[model samples]
Target: MKLYDVIVAGATGMVGRKMIQVLEERKFPVGKLFPMASSHSVGKRVVFNGKEWTVQELNEENIKNSHAKIALFSAGASVSRHFAPICAKYDITVIDNSSAWRMDPSIPLVVPEVNREKIFSGSKIIANPNCSTIQMVVVLKPLHDKYKIKRVVVSTYQSVTGAGQKGHDQLMKEWNEEEIQEMKFPHQISFNAIPHIDEFLDNGYTKEEMKMINETKKIMGDNSIQVSPTCVRIPTIGGHCESVNIEFEKPFELSDVREILSKAPGVVVQDKPLEKIYPMPIWAHDKDEAFVGRIRRDETVKNGLNLWIVSDNIRKGAATNAVQIAEEFIKGK
Candidate 1:
């Protein structure tokens, strides 16, 4: 058996830590695991596959020293912009979980369930789509293939944990006491929903929202498919929930829609409203598949349908998705 050396950048952060867990859960062929982080976190230890691996400081010199075959980077865009290309230069295929190269035409923004074909052996760096966009596209792919989707309007109820541990800590601060504090978020995240994620662009849409709009088109492999998005941060944890309304070029029966999603890979349908069984963050936390429910027809438009999608933003959204891309690459061999 051939085991590949794997390096995880930002190994101490929220997404980075989960990436290690997913790697073990899926039983990836790892020869040596390099857990890399910033200088402040260099000595910390992370448990993976029942062994504690010490974190290494990430830098151009140390990075160039490795012979790792695959690198999963969850560091911010700056780190990715500087080191990802360097890692690729070492012939390491990078699966980056950041907004860095998602919009770059040269890089393939991949959602394994939706566009595994975009990832190839020669592909240097693969971009993971935004957390909100991923779950929506997983559900959208099957419907789009069947109904020929025309347009999609999505409103995301994102968990605070999506902002990383600091956002979660800030929310906890407010929850533990009545006193409020300014956070990485522009406004309070506990007991309130902020209508912003990332910087607000001149077009009145935040960078996060635009990522959803454009990344959806790229992953779906159709620029003609329009997407409108409103990304909001809530005090919830575990997962992100999206209310998506889609219009298709062809009409689809409600039962067929349910059947399609139920059978789709990495998607589960939980649409029994009378029994009060629908997708929720609490249930979706730590789960791998995207939970989709609240399926119905939109009476206002032709060939319109609505869906509620939920998934652990850290799991399927980042760590699991990146690992799946690597799996697809391996399977292609």
Candidate 2:
């Protein structure tokens, strides 16, 4: 077995730290771990594979000298935009968690279960889809294959972690009734839900909502598939939950839908309405699989189905998904 040197950008941040943890949890063939971050976060220590690794500055000198084959980037879009090409220049495969390269026609917005084949050896930079989009597509792919999906309507009750550390801190501050200093959210997040995730666009839909709409089509490889999304940030530290209503082109039975999702990779069917069972963020936390429940026909629309999708945003949505893409690369080898 050959071990590979890996670089984790933004090592001190929430997603970056989780990337390190997932790499170890999955027991990736990692020989040397290079944890990189901004100047402020440098010298911070991250434990990987039970070893303490110091965070280094993400400068050209360090990136060029790291001798790493794969770089998992959870840094902001600005950082990814500036450094991802540099990693690609050094022949390092960059699986970016930011939206910097997701819409790029040349780059592949990847969800391994749906389109692992899009990735190839020469593919230098692969864009990991938005956390919300990743979980929804994982469940949608199997259903879309069985019955052609025409449109999708999704309302997300996302976790505070999706906004990074600041978001979590904001919720905690509100929960503790401390003095509110800086605002990560527009309003209080504790015991309240904000209908906004990212910046509001000219189209009245936020950047996060648009990401769901566009990303879903791209990952599913169907531009014709329509997606209407309203993303909300709720006070939760566990995971993200979505109320997904899917309309298929063909009629389908609930039994077949349940069977398809149960067998789908990275999907867990938790529907048991009679037993008072369904997916929830508390139960889905720290797990990689997308939990799907409340599987039933939407009586309002023809050929419609509704589902509740839940998954750990930090795990499957960010860290685990990026690691899975790296795993796909290793499998190709």
**What TM-score, computed on C-alpha atoms, does each candidate reach?**
0.97, 0.98
What's the residue-level lDDT of 286 in candidate 1?
Answer: 93
Best by lDDT: 2
Please give, for residues 241-276, the per-residue lDDT of candidate 1 as tens digits: 999999999988999988898999999999999999
Q: Pairs clashing in candidate 2?
A: none
Per-candidate local distance difference test: 0.91, 0.94
Worst 10 residues of 1 by lDDT: 177-186
lDDT of 2 by residue, 84-157 (tens): 99999998999999999999989999999999988783679999999999999999999999999999999999
Clashes of each: 0, 0
Error of 2 at 34 (Å): 0.4
How does candidate 1 score on lDDT? 0.91
